[model samples]
Each structure stands twice: as structure tokens, then as C-alpha cells.
Target: MGTLSPAAPPTTPERTKSRLLEAVKDCDCATAQALADKLGVTVPAIRRHLQDLQDAGQLEVRTEKPGGRGRPQHVYVLTEAGEATFPKAYATLCVDVLDQVERLFGDGAVLRVMDARRLEFQGVLASRLAGHSDLGRKLTALAAVLCEYGYAARAYQENGQWYLTQRNCPAPAVAKAFPQLCQAELTLYRDLLELPVSREARLSCGAAECRYKVG
Candidate 1:
């Protein structure tokens, strides 16, 4: 008798797991039930995949008790290791180039380059925020511009002061190496809004998000 062929390898589950990971990536946290609903899979299936991912150190879980709920719900978020698996090229290349620049030119030369970048962004911000006189309006416009550049920025008022919050920093690795970039961002906001700006939190400093307080 002829040799029997092996069955085809299963891939749909793997694809579903990837999709689940991506969905969690887009949110602060996600529950397994929500993930199942979004992915059109059974809760047991979602739990199985989540367990696998957790075992692999790619996911972390937290239990939340919605008040008056029957049971606490499990929420999942990607660990730093998991986030690292996503595509990111800007930071690595930027740091490499900056390292080369420092080796070739000097520390002062790197500072000068950063300063030039700050000045260039100042002009661009001013133009983008033009015609918005009210601080709140200007902040809103500024947030839009930042979001366009991949900052995932939003502006809102709290405690009688306006704030701009960036949920994600597109250049985290670069910022970690060159803190001047963070300073430049604060300076740019101050110059553009024509108001005093203070950095309340910084992503590079391990804050969950980057927050700027504006007045």
C-alpha cells in the first residue's frame, strides 16, 4: 500500500491568536470575552490561546471586579516583551546614527543638531496652530498635529487647566537616548501655544503616558 500523507498543519488558531494580540495592543486592556466576541471565537478558545500566550510571557493578566458583579473579570495586556515583538525601526536606526554622530563630531555637535530640529519644529507648529487664539482651541489643534505624527495624542481639560496627553511615544528608544527630544517637544508646545507649558509626566521616565500641562 502507498504511504499515507500526513494531515495539513493547523494555522487558523495561530492566526486568531495573533489577531487577539493585536486587538489587545490597540487598547489599554481587554477581557477574554471581549476578545472572543471581536474575533468570533468561543470564550474557551480565547482562554486557551490567552493561556498559551501568558505561558509564553507575552501577556499579563489582571482581575477587575466591576462593582456589583457576580464574578471578577480577567483583563489582559501585552507585556513589554510582547510589545517589543511589534515592528519598530525608527528608534534603533536613530540611536545608531546618533551614536555615530557623537563619535564623529562630538557631544556638542549632537546638541546643536537637536537644537536645530527643535527650531525647525517650532516653525512647523506655529503654522499648524495658526488662527487658534483660545488656549483650549490651540491645544486641540496642537494635539491633532501631534497625533498625525504618531504620538497618539489627545487634549482635554481637567482641574481648570488644559492638558495634552500622548498615550504612545513613537520614538521611545530615541527619547531614552536623547532626552533633549523630550525637552524640545515641551519647548515646541510652549512656543506654539504662546503659553507656559510644564511636563507633568514623561514616557521615557517610565510613566504610562507622556503628559504636558498647559496654561
Candidate 2:
């Protein structure tokens, strides 16, 4: 988002749109004005690109409560598909190791390895989220850490229940190759949050996002 040279209007819409998407994802520019400033483009031009991205299902808007008067503020965030536009940093080497695990040992040994990884992550998450006694606060803290871990996670409330959704999986190949990793991941969340966390959707099952509900 630093001093990006602006492209001329509509002529280079694709290039401009690509830059705009990067601004939204990396710079967290939720507003048209902010995106314009970051990309060195006009507000109206930015708005057009924003609409195009939204129509393509790459981004979604959330209308937050108004701070003062007037209408609520609309903020845009990347959808799972949008997150897919970026490069994934998962190590294929891990997948190779996991495959060897299944070959040399048995299915039980593979589950044990994934479980061990889950336990380590559980300890890290629990320690960071320890001070948040309330369920909502704990969920929010969990989201922050998940994002840091490249999960692109969000925490929100619906129907008086807290939810966690991850748009990106750090180890997509590992998850796809071994169902045990997915199960271990669910177990980690339940154990760390100390609640009966139920999975509503899973990326492994062809869902765009992986969703969990706190009960």
C-alpha cells in the first residue's frame, strides 16, 4: 500500500482491480476512500472496482453500528475465494512426512502425530487466551491468533451464540490427505476454549470456509 503508482481509469481495470484487492487484503482498507488513498486512485474509481470485486464474490461488506449520526459504516473484508488469490505458505514437505507416517506406521500412528501437533497449538492458544474469562472475549482472542497463524479467522455472534470461521487453512494438503488433522483441529478448539465447540462447516468437506459454533 506504499506509494503504489496509479493506473489510468478503466483502461487498466484488471491491473487496478488486482492492486485494489491487495490493498483490501494487506492494508485492511475497508472503505473506498481509504483504498483510494492507498492505491493513489480517485474515490469513485475505487468504488467501481470495489463493486466489481463484491459482485464476483471476492469481498463482502459488513455494516457496523453508526458511531454518531447518519447511516452505519460499511466495511469490506475478503471472502475465502478472495483469500485464495494470495499465495499459500503451507509446506508440502509436511505432507510428504505425513504420507510416510501412514506408510511406515499405521493409520493410528498418523492420528497420534496430528494429535501431538494439536496439543502443542492448544497450549499456545490457551495461554494467550487465558485472561479472557468471558466466552465472547475468548473467541475474539482466538480469532486474532488464528489470523496470525494464516487461518484468516473471524469471530462473531449470531442468534446469541459465538462462532469462529476460518477462510484459509494453513495446511490445506495435510488436511486433505489426512482426515485425522481435521479432527485434531476440532479437538484443539474445543479443548482450548473449554466449551463444546461444534463444527458447522469444514473446508475439507468442500466448504469455502470452516465454521465452528460455541455451545
Candidate 3:
């Protein structure tokens, strides 16, 4: 006799509702029509799902007026509750550990940890960047590693300059508490690239992205 296969997990009342929630997660904010178009569903059906999620505290709605529009559009954003449904790696935990280390030891101890992390990051980058003779190729490999660690990173060339930009910061909490993290990363890139990698902006500094360029 053949053995029984494992059963599939139970789903919510409407699978489309889950998709709608994910849509908001992806865009960070979306309108009913946009979600409908993305999921290939009717507007009315999408509204129902958005309403249900809002009622259940899974989303928040905001009103936005288009530059040229007859009616203000309703935008949906995932609430803390909705965000909880997705997979996450809490960088706050890293902040907590750093706090404990600072408490037990001192600021000097935390700085040392930052230095150690700089070495570790350098090692990882060096391994992947091996044999990448072109500067663009090296930055592309570095971008891949950063994305794997949750920083949404991209490498590109513009105006005859090569740049690495990170749109998302994986460890905001840690970076906020320990400015050393930023400094250490800066030092690491300089050492590894053997060139001056100037930082044009920083996400932690409220800029749109953390940008580094070879000049």
C-alpha cells in the first residue's frame, strides 16, 4: 500500500485576502484598484478583502488626492499586526545584545565588536569579489551579499561613475544605537576595495539610500 501524503496547511477564508495583504507589504502602500489589477480580481471583490483586513486590524487606510482626479483614492498600508504575518528577522535582538555588552563592559567594548564585524564583513566580500577584475563586477557581487543580509542593494554605473546604493537598512536599530557600525562598514569598504569609497548618503541619516561611490 502507498503511504498517505502530508496534508496541506489550512488557509484563511479567502486566499485572495492573503494576497491583498502581501500586496500592501510589497508596495508598503497600495490602492484597491491597484491590488485588484495585480491579483486579476474585480474592484468590488478587492475592496471587500481590504475592508475585512482593516476591520481585523490587519491594515490601515489613508486618503490621498491625486494631482488631477475626481475622487480621492483610498490607500491601504499594512499595520504592525499585518506585518507580523510575514517572515522577519528582528534586528532589534542585535541591538539588545550590543546594549548588554555595553552595560557589562563599556563603549570601548562595543567599538571593538564593531571592528570585529568589519573584519568579518570584509572576509565575506573578499571571497565573493575574488576574480572580479572589473570594478563594476566587484560592486555587483557586494550588492548580492548585502541583499542576502536584508539590505535591498543595487550596483550600477551612471555618468561614468560606479555606485553602490542600499535602499533598505537591515539593522536600523543597531545602527541607530551604535554609530560605530556605519564607521566600521566605511572602513571595511575602503580596505577591501583599496580605493576611496565615498559615502554620498546614509539611510540612517534620513536620506533615501546609503550610497557609496568609487571616485
Identify the candidate with maximal TM-score.
Answer: 1
Give the alpha carbon lDDT tens digit for every residue of 51-86 in model 3: 999999999999987665668888899899999888
Per-residue lDDT tens digits for candidate 2, residues 105-197, read 987989999888898988898889978999888899999999999999999999898899999987777788888988999999888877898
In model 2, what lDDT does residue 109 have? Answer: 86
Instruction: Pick the winner on lDDT between candidates 1 and 2.
Output: 2
Tens-digit lDDT track of model 1 for 1-215: 99999998776877877888898887654898788888788899889999999998999998876554768888899998788778878779999998899899987777778889988988888888788988888889988988899889999998898999998998898999988788778877787777888998999999999999888
Model 2 regions lying over 4 Å from their true place: 1-91
State every prediction's TM-score relative to the real structure. Answer: 0.61, 0.58, 0.58
TM-score of 2: 0.58
Question: Model 2 Cα RMSD, Å?
Answer: 14.3
The residue pairs in collision within model 3 are: none
TM-score of 1: 0.61
- In model 3, how many backbone clashes occur? 0
